[model samples]
Target: MGKLRWNILGIRGNPLATRPGMVKIQEKNVMLRKCWKTLLIGILFTLTLLIAGCWDRKEIENRGYVLGVGIDHVVSSGPKGLYDLDKTPQAAGQRKYKLTIEMPKFNKQEASKEVNKGQNHLIWSGEGESMFAITRMISTKTYFSPFFEDIQILVFSEAVAREGVGDILDFFLRDAEMRRLTRVFVTPGRAEDILKAKLQVEEVNSTFIGKLTANTDKAPYFAGKAELGQIAQALRSNHSFIVPIIVTEDKEVRLLKGAIFNKDHKMVGEMNELEILGGKILRQTLKQGIVVAPNPADPQHTVAFEIYEKKMNIDTSVQDDQILFTVKVILIGNLGENMVHEQDAVDPVFTKAVEKEIAAEVTRSIKAAFSKQQQLKADVTELGDLVHRQHPDYWKNVQDRWDEEVFPMAQLNVDVKIQIRRPVITH
Candidate 1:
């Protein structure tokens, strides 16, 4: 019937019991936590609206995928290569460029309902003072917006290439949608005709041409793949480069030679198929090519050696203001054909003789290509790069004149060694 005893600190028997104003403080803390939870939920809900979906996304079906582009200079307005311009503000001799683009024709029907049958691409063209302007003008004619991200090839007419590709490529280099890996080519005639030419292997002519460039390893005649980025880099560095050449005849297009360009990005000349074969071997490396040499036994007949693997090294040195480049090439392949009926493949002497003949033939081809380069005064083989890397101090003195003067006067020595592994045919 008595009250419990308390400690000196005003604590009861239960030490954990709440004191007088603690109830109000606990109530205030609970209220604060609830407010914070509600505020956090509101912030999360607002953030969800901001990131609900892609704001700048475009539907794939509505985008026109541009696969190929061609450029040609408008020379005349009369009967041939007629260009229709209502009014002109420029001078008399000022030139305009024509642009052509190839895009896939979207097939919406089922397989059984297909009508066009083997027609899967369409070509659209326009003309303007600049490529960017031309591209914008072309967009207006298309139902879907032209997308350049998938562009596979760019072809320029000989006239346009001769005038200088720097101006035309400026737009492609600067555009965010354009890809740097797009292949580049030069055609002797109208580039639009190349795009319009029919192809039996591929549905799209642009794709076929692009694939053809990839066969440089198999075919020595090919100029190899010249990419947009590589050309841009060459132009930026003021170095000479080469673009593959193509010709269209009887509704068929054929990749033939290489259009050589000088330091100014102007087409100076072209490299023939044989010259390309040698250049590829000397400058880079060739995977396949035929080497024809006069047979030792029979002077009239010839022997063919097929190149399967090749490796090369080019070194440069400067002495008394004279530059000398030494190129060493090692080629290993099989005996493709032997017209000499007397020579036997089983004999080591015969194989050695054949190897020597093949080496001489390779040397001659390379020298011929080097001679052509000297004649044009264009260093398409990237010889300047060798000097810059090997002899930097000397390169600085003649860097400006490397392509025009120094490279032409430079002496080149090509040393080739050949090995015939598998002789398929004897005699």
Candidate 2:
């Protein structure tokens, strides 16, 4: 290759007009300035490349892609819910959350299949006052680094939830590497048990739980999915919210009912699938809830309607210093299971009777949920938020005691409307 040469031929700054020596000096000065400019440009280019280092890049093999995280309340080795730190940090009753993470290794998973033929994922836990601390401590127990960029789910034990998840949520929210869409759950016994449960369908318990939650279309009302960011928003707004419940039994994990959080961001109680119905109706997210009503023609048999469409209207008003809440739920579904031996599914009269029965069933269920909410002193139905939106003045007046006093004493009127169709019939 031929060397390329740059030619900067200046005419010696008009040597004929000025003194030759002076002109020569000027040309020299000009040449020096050009050389310095070129050197500075090269140095700046090299510096730019040096500064453009990849700070966020990480090798895939180096990352321990966390699939799920479980948080549990660890009783310090001391008292029931109390622990003296002076004794030992590992006391029985100190307020501590044991955080667990599930990470799957594909290569090791295949190897394990050939070896013991068991699980493909690893579950590790550590104890700390905050999730952030426990997450870091988890590194001590694992050879690979604990990474959160791919975390799919976060499970909270009933005990941990009762203590409030606001602090845990803060760490997740503040973490730049965490996914905002990470699903959250509350377990009845312990989150670690749920995380360690052996899943028959899936090798990893977290995978099974994640897949279960992903089936929202089957039961959108009860099998609801709440992301980490969503819970944080509710926490920031100081609103009571609900998280799905997961239970472990006989080496199996299943997502069941839901856990209720109060305005203080602590789990106050749990909701049956039916109580979840009321919340769904109130929130207008009641897409699928099976209503089993008494057989219209035969009292012995029952009829089940699979809710396909639901619409709810909440009318709140303050009358005579009393908060009155009216929840009108209109449901449209078809006869999914008709065990009413005396009643025919195709019969219009029987169907009409079934509709009324199912409507009443839903109404009663919702009313039960309302009673439960009153019992728990939680407004998970967002009734208080609704009242606050319409009547800010009223909300302001009762905001302090809305849950304990006003909500419990409030009059809730439920109106249910049902429409049913035969299985073969469309629309």
Per-model TM against the reference: 0.82, 0.79
Choose the strongest candidate by TM-score. Answer: 1
Q: Per model, how many backbone clashes are there?
A: 0, 9
Query: Mind giving the per-residue lDDT tens digits that candidate 2 earns over 62-177?
Result: 67888898888775564545453452264233446778888876676474664233356777888767677677767767667888887888998888789888877888899899
RMSD of each: 5.8, 6.3
lDDT for each residue of candidate 1 in 211-284, tens digit (9 for 90 to 100): 77766777776788899999989988988888899898765677889999988889999998878877886667
Which window of ten consecutive residues has the lowest lDDT sum in model 1?
A: 1-10
Model 1 Cα displacement at 414 (Å)? 2.3
* Residue 97 local lDDT, model 1: 84
User: In model 1, which regions exceed 4 Å deviation?
Assistant: 1-51, 79-95, 108-118, 250-252, 287-302, 339-343, 424-427
